[model samples]
Target: MSSRFRLFDRTAVMGSGYIFAMVNRMQMLYYILILPKHLVQPYMIVGILGVGVLSQINLFILAKYLTSNYFVLGYRGFVQLFSEKIVRFFALLGIFFILIKVIVTTLGYVEIVHQFMFPSMKTSWLIFVLMASGFYIASQGMEKTIRLSIISFLATIWVILVYIPYFLPPISEIHHLYPLVPGEVSLHSWYGLLMVWSALSGPEYLVCLGPWIGPKEKILRGMSIGNALSVFEYLVLFVACLLYYGSPYLEKISFPVVNMIRYLQSPVFERVDLILISLNMIYFLYLIALFLLCLYGAIRIVAGRINIKTNRKGFLGSVAAVFICMLIINGWYWREG
Candidate 1:
């Protein structure tokens, strides 16, 4: 007998812990790896905190929607609110957004892996291997894919502690954090604030997972904690970068966080940075899998087949289409920003 493909099947309602893990991990995507280089000014530390507060307020509004009776209804809830036609239209728009996110995120990480981990390897093979891993994880169904979030969180969160050495004397300079206030603000400073806001944006996507997320009362608490943690991680990272490289030197580094990891020396492990990068893959794969599943669901909704039984061919075809798009963009359009 052939197995049935049920991409959105929800066997269990996940608690706030899952929500917390997912939100935290989503906010800490590939962008966080390169954020410090963009917001190199020490005064931008204030931007990080300010944007984090704004993100919290936004999450408050989002929590209202998530807690409503309509939210748990999932697709039907959206249909009731916007009508089937409008919901379909929204799903249509979602397809493009999801595609761009998956493409950019996957390709960005592939470039990192290519540059840092395997410079000798072709980028195309790296993309294939990563997507295949994601496809296999996503094939397990939404619940399992979501359950992987906690694992992803735990596996990589400890890496933050590795940066502690950067905070101490020999590697760090007290004067590097001086002049924490900006004397004259410019367009570049505002741009840095916007980047910080953008970095904290992944929680908004949680609105779509209403059916799986639970304990409506605790949703806000979970999300708030997650958002707070993301900000703290951002602060820790940016400060460490400043202490280690200072604002002027930080501006020149491409991947400041990854480069900082390279500075550490371990007796047993020849390449500690490589090990951390590999561990980072757990969350990267988790997110790619989650988005792949989301993309397939969006495709189904757009095709007016939300109720239809999912088949392997349709699912594989959607993933393949995305893979091809990645290949095309990587080959022709992708440029290092």
Candidate 2:
């Protein structure tokens, strides 16, 4: 029966390269799109760097857990660390966390598509399309979903190069980057730093992929490379925002990174921003699929069905429940602040 639905089956071990791709793509999720508006000061660059260093330290600790003997045992590892009841309790808590993350990420990206790509379209339809894509990818099972990380990374990584024009002369203003250090600090500045820290998250979730990722020794090195590249990307985007819009003007613009992309005048394509925004769907789908699988697994664990075979009805019902939750939130509660 388990062989019939091999969602959690591990046939071959993926290397450190997969780990690198997954970590980098996960950290560079939806938050990066609107980060510049929140971090509206030049000195916040320092905050990014500082938070990045702290994230690296956090990854080091995570590496220890990933490489541990117990991790290779998967669910039994948690059972050994705590008891079966405690593990189930954690899984129960995880269901809520996974749902929240999935809801925010899917709806956030849907809002972008609604505003920019399809202003006339209903946001609920956009959410359904995106969630359906995610469900398809996740249904392929964990190994293939993990493999999608590299494709997601390759597809969106070049979008950063498009921002190069913002950093050059003519478009860039020298004074915008002035006062590299903050003149005065406030609680708002601390909040901006906290955002950076939050952005560097998602790597810790790699603990769940122990059966697929290897060799154990290379895990930390791969994670470090991915983490470093994410920081570098953040620095480039934030600096380009500063140079293009300056600190004062940057605060007023929503989706500064996407807006910067809109300024690029391609001779062939009139709406280059739309094309790139669509390209972003690849990674966004990868994340949603990854989280969807994680959510389902957590559900099974909490339900004490970890040893049972996966069935189409159970999986589809779970995905449908999430889709319904997203619709309810979009219809009632989700308001951009």
Candidate 3:
């Protein structure tokens, strides 16, 4: 039971891991990189500013609500009986949410990779690599994930800063942003943005980490830093994509961020998008590990309170096995679809 609690403590760090994972797995290959072929640049500006803004706010609210109720109060307050029950319920719900998200992301990534990078590679191989990496990281637990996240986040910032000059020259006009908000934002777009934003909630990763953290204040501080990092990363990436490609191009590209950076040419460098892709891949790997940790945590909470006996290694391995199986099934489905 105590080890189960420990796992949840670490998962709280991995909750927000999906954001970076999404950026790499879904956003890069599918949208931005493909933008120039379909849409121009102006429409993308519209989508990013309009849809992106609403999405962040919506996701923040959802994160705040869910994090407070499930991770912070319910699971973290392990000593309390009432909190335990609430935590268990929310843990299951979180598992369901993450599973759905992982499936959709896996499908989207498959499409992106199939279209962009490796048309020749079988999707199952990709899944295997992803699962292998995910399992390796999940086995390490939360501390390494958190530490690695900090490093990845820092490294990406340096990469962006180093490459900033190339993108500076082709700055598009703000008048391109003329009609800011459309007639009315649709519910579907709103939902999309909300999903994007909710995708940033990383505190759920902390569920696996709570016990490891000595002081309550330290956990709060970590959550603050992690969430802030997520918001800032999204904002910077969104702005970079919008500024480089504009809204017109955004509507066309499958992954705007990668496309925005791909064409970057200097005397020294030809294609910066390659570097960005590598960096994003690192981030995504870290994020996937985080999600696995979170799933492991959630399962532990439910299993423990229910008096199901399972060791921590057994529990984590079981969850990873399940996730990998799901990824395989999803990959094959999308292959046929």
Candidate 4:
């Protein structure tokens, strides 16, 4: 292998607790464009922060319990907090959710890449490449996955600066930032408010991460800061979308966040969004690995069947099966389209 080309260093393992928090933030970065349309209003910044408090509530609930509980009991300790049957049942439900999410998210990103990055490429080939990339990261163990998560976060943090154009006028309307109509929040807006909470969904995987962290490191500060940063990023994106397109119009668009990035072709570098989207795959790949690792944990929790540690290939096979299903489902959609 050439020094110029590298995959990942196999020997470099880092603190899982530190990496997990940053990974938490990375997982939710995609939500910046999507959630704003749901929750932001004319009083954009204030509206988002107001809704943000509610969004962070559920995250805080899990963070409060998990960090404290994990510090003392770890996974078994946290698991025993619930009845044996109850914990297993929920873990099974989590398996179902994570399985669907992993498949759908990979398929969705593949479609995005197909549309934006590789218009002429075959979707089948793209799916194959994606699953292969995911499996590569998965085989690295949770330690290495966390390491990649840290490095990817550093690499992609600059993408946030790409939004500077959207924040300025006449692309953005300053008038939209003011309060328009004031009354009791409508049921639809209320429902959208609740949906903002989903932006914080991926952090709960920290519970399964206890084993990955050695006894010396603590996760409380890591999880708390990570959770806080995810919410803050969501708020910034949410408001940015509202500033660009007011609430009513924002809701009509699909993938507002992605489009927000798409709408701005940088004055400095043309079609910067395209380059950013390609760079974003670095973070997305890490997230896919993270999700698969979490799915592996869920399977162990519910079935106690597979030992991912000893049989690395078994874990990779299980992850491959999930991604393959995306292509299987894609056929039905293709036929309909």
**Per-candidate local distance difference test:** 0.90, 0.90, 0.53, 0.65
Q: Indicate the residue-level lDDT of 240 in model 3.
A: 60
Error (Å) of candidate 3 at residue 333 is: 4.9
* TM-score of each model, in listed order: 0.98, 0.98, 0.68, 0.80
Put down candidate 4 lDDT per residue, 44-136, tens digits, no spaces: 455546655654565566556554644344446655777667767888898888877777666777777777778899888987887789878
The reply for model 1, stretches above 4 Å from the true place, is: 1-3
- How many clashes show up per model? 0, 0, 44, 1
Candidate 1 local Cα displacement, residue 123, angstroms:
0.5
Cα deviation at 236, candidate 1, in Å, is: 0.3
Over the stretch 127-177, how does candidate 2's per-residue lDDT look in tens digits? 999999999999999999999999999988998898898888999998999
Residues forming the 10-long window of minimal summed lDDT in candidate 1: 1-10
Give the local distance difference test score of model 1: 0.90
Residue pairs in candidate 1 whose N, alpha carbon or C atoms collide under 3 angstroms: none
What is the C-alpha local distance difference test score of candidate 2?
0.90
Tens digits of per-residue lDDT, candidate 3, 1-337, equal: 5455343234333333433332223232223333333323333334444444454454455445444433344455653635667767877888777665555554555555554567798776666676677667766656666557656565555654643553465574445444544555566555545444445434444444443333332333334444444445444555566556566666666666555565657677786555555565665666667667667667776676434443565655666676676666664555432
lDDT of 2 at 296: 92
Candidate 4 lDDT (Cα, 0 to 1): 0.65
For every candidate in turn, the CA RMSD to the true structure comes to 1.0, 1.2, 6.1, 5.1
